[model samples]
Target: MHPLAKYAIGFVVLCFLLFLLAPFAIVPSGMRGVVTTFGKVDPVPLGEGIHLIMPLANRVVRIDVRVQKAETEGDAASRDLQQVVTKIALNYHLDPAHVSTVYQRIGEDVENRLIDPAVSEVFKSVTARYTAEELITKREEVREQISRALVARLTPYGILVDQFSITNFRFSAAFNQAIEAKVTAEQNKLKAERDLQRIQVEAEQKIASAKAEAESLRLQKQEVTAELLKLRAVENQRLAIEKWDGRLPTVSGGATPLISINPQQ
Candidate 1:
């Protein structure tokens, strides 16, 4: 063989050797790698960065240990046997130190297999302890209960529950209508009470006005003298004479007819 051909073959061998020795695996940030040799899984997980392992015998499976969010919807029965549909948002993360164990036991699909079911179960358990009305009105308390229960249940499984929120709660149509009707009735009752108060205030004002008028009349009567009374009687007689028709007076008794004179004269 020629000298150049030999050099080309040597270069090809060097390249093949380099390719075979490339066993470095890079575990990205926020993730851990589970190293398995043949069929046996390593107890210690590889942290983020480049790691060297047996090229052909060892396989690295990366599992994300960062916080993740999931939204789930389900229905549960309340304490009063009312059906309630709930939507929840959950924030959780896998334990970084137990990535290998989690992979071996729970697999990478933890959200679907473990967390989602846990959420449903916790929701059902907590919801059953309260009535539907209480669930709707006391939503914060219900969410806290569910969160505590989920944390207690999932913590041992190498999963951490960071937060939980009840996004929506839906009830049956009949119940919603009843709630609306109840609200309307309460508003009407308040309006009726205000109207009654207004009427009572008006009635009180009228009574006060009548009492004031009676007092004014009594004061004027107290200010009257006998001479003033006589003057008022003369004025009344003058007004009656002016309004009388031209007719002779008819007397059936032996009573004397007296004439009145003006006090100004």
Candidate 2:
């Protein structure tokens, strides 16, 4: 071989060695390298250490099997025929045992086709059971029911739902206004009833006071009548003596007492 050709051949060999060694040089922590040979995945996962594979035709795909989050927002109609915007936050992780199935069916970007639709379906199905008011007031119940539904639905798809939260809810403008008006009217009715009850109590107290005063006056009038009767009797006796004429008849030791009264004398 010519001298220049020999040097070129040596450089090409060095470059091939560098490419094979470079991929295995750095394996980050918390990452596993999956080695595929001839388009077939090996059973064992490569750990955080150097690994060697064929410089040509073999490759390592890093799969991060840690827990991940999938947040989704969707709108559904409530039983009351109102539209509501709902936010869903889901905590999920890959089933390491089912990694092969996950790769086969939906691949790493499975959240879009699988998880996203599953979440939307659960929200729509669950919201159909409740009105918008119930959803707002009993949020925890809705959240628990949705979580269970999501876990059951996604489990078979190689996705494990850890937990979920129903983050926010919003209703349409017209429905919200109607609800506020209803609440306000109910409060006003309750306040009016309370005021009427208070007035009735006060009227009862005044009636009791009037009855007591009237009874006291009746007793006082009875007492004044008894004293007036005694005075009237004494006044009649004095009038009879003063009106007697100056004529007298005598009896054995007593003079006739005047029994009639003459006012002319």
Candidate 3:
């Protein structure tokens, strides 16, 4: 064997060794790596970026820490025993600080095994407390109840909840039709009340007008006394005298004309 050939073989062996054992692991952005040794998860979680690890003994499982959406639907009975179908959307992410703990207990499929069941359980529990009528009328309250319940349930498992929303609530067709018909009937009743009030106001105005006219006639009648009648007759005679020319007419007595005239003096 030559000395150069021995050096070449040593270099190839070193390269092969390096290839077989990864010197370091890369944790990408928005993810945390849970370190495990011989299938046992380490207590401490790995933050994003490169981290030193044992070549053949350590493994890194990258779990996403970014916010994610999980939408699910289920049917539950209301307090009134009405069947209600609810669709809910949950926004959550694994706690970056507890990635190792989460991985150890629940593994990678947290959304399905943990978050989904949590949502369904909390929703059904909260929904059962509200009657079907109250569910529709107090929707926000029901949603709040469900969200708070989920937060409490998942927190211990190192799942941080971002937001929860109830996307849809469906009721039976008969119940929906009943609600619509009730609303229409209430509207008709309100219209009738307003119309009756308007008619009453118009009647009051007409009665007031008639009373005012009658009062005016009574005042005119009260002023017509005997003195007023005499005064009217005297006024008419004075008007007639003002219009007459001063003259005397001859009168016939026993078929003879009697004329009386005075000479101008």
Candidate 4:
């Protein structure tokens, strides 16, 4: 009946009303609210905005259904027994329709509980199938394989794989050094082969030139010999005619020398 007591009672009622209305939850954009009644999850999920449920009996768990990125790094072995250090990144999101199931089954730590382990396991398995060289040369293939495997493994758990990538791959220092040495050796071998071919070509050209020069000289020598023989023959004929006399003369000096007797006057 007192004014103060009435005001006090009114204040208590106001507080109780506020407490009762506290069960109404606002699911923000890009999120889904999972309702659990008496620890049992409801099949239907609550979408974004205000949601009302039984006060003190139902709980709403909000889950982000937007795309998220996760990165992980681990060591794996190649098919050739080479140690490979790999880092991978993934984009994923919770399936909005399965939000309740996802929360109930795996809770809110989807990155650690599901996606991260999946990345490591899939990467190791896929890496084990390829050699270290293949892992580098066929990076796109490796990425596709990882993405496919991740989708297959995580899809059943209400996690959708949006995209996956192999960010980095590294080998041991000794192995890297060996690769460099091998490449250098191959290049040197190729250069040597080219040099040898060039030398062979040059030698052939020189031999051909020498043959040509020798042939030219031989022709010139034959021409000179024929000309000299013709000249000598002509000179011999001329001397014989000049020495012949009109009359025969006496022989002299025990030799066949012909002498002219001044025409015998």
Q: Where in model 4 is the C-alpha error above 4 Å?
A: 1-12, 204-265
Give a tens-digit lDDT track for model 4, residues 154-259: 9999999888877789999999999999899999999999999999999999999999999999998888876798898899989987998865666667776655
Off by over 4 Å in 1: 1-11, 17-21, 226-265
Q: What is the lDDT of residue 140 in candidate 4?
A: 95
**Clash pairs for candidate 2:** none
Kindly give the stretch of ten consecutive residues in candidate 2 with the minimal lDDT sum.
19-28
**lDDT for 193 (candidate 2):** 100
Evaluated against the true structure, the overall lDDT of model 2 is: 0.82
How displaced is residue 34 in candidate 1, in Å? Answer: 1.2
Q: Report clashes for each candidate as comma-separated counts.
A: 0, 0, 0, 0
lDDT of 1: 0.91
Root-mean-square deviation of Cα positions for candidate 1 versus the true structure, in angstroms: 6.3
Candidate 1 weakest lDDT stretch, 10 residues? 253-262
Residue-wise lDDT of candidate 3 within 1-265, one digit each (tens)? 9999999999999998877898789999999999999999998989988898998899999999999999989689999888899889989998899999999999899989998888888888998999989998999999899988998999999999999998888999988898899999999999999999999999999999999999999999999999999999999999988987765444567455555768873
Superposed model 2: Cα runs more than 4 Å off: 1-18, 21-27, 52-57, 211-265
Q: Candidates sorted by TM-score, descending order?
A: 3, 1, 4, 2
User: Which candidate gets the maximum TM-score versus the true structure?
Assistant: 3
Alpha carbon deviation, residue 145, candidate 3 (Å): 0.8
lDDT of 1 by residue, 1-265 (tens): 9999999999999889868776779999999999999968898999989999888888999999999998889789999988999889999999999988888998889989898899899999999999988998898899889989999999989999888888799999998998899999999999999999999999999999999999999999998999999999999999999998956578888675766768998
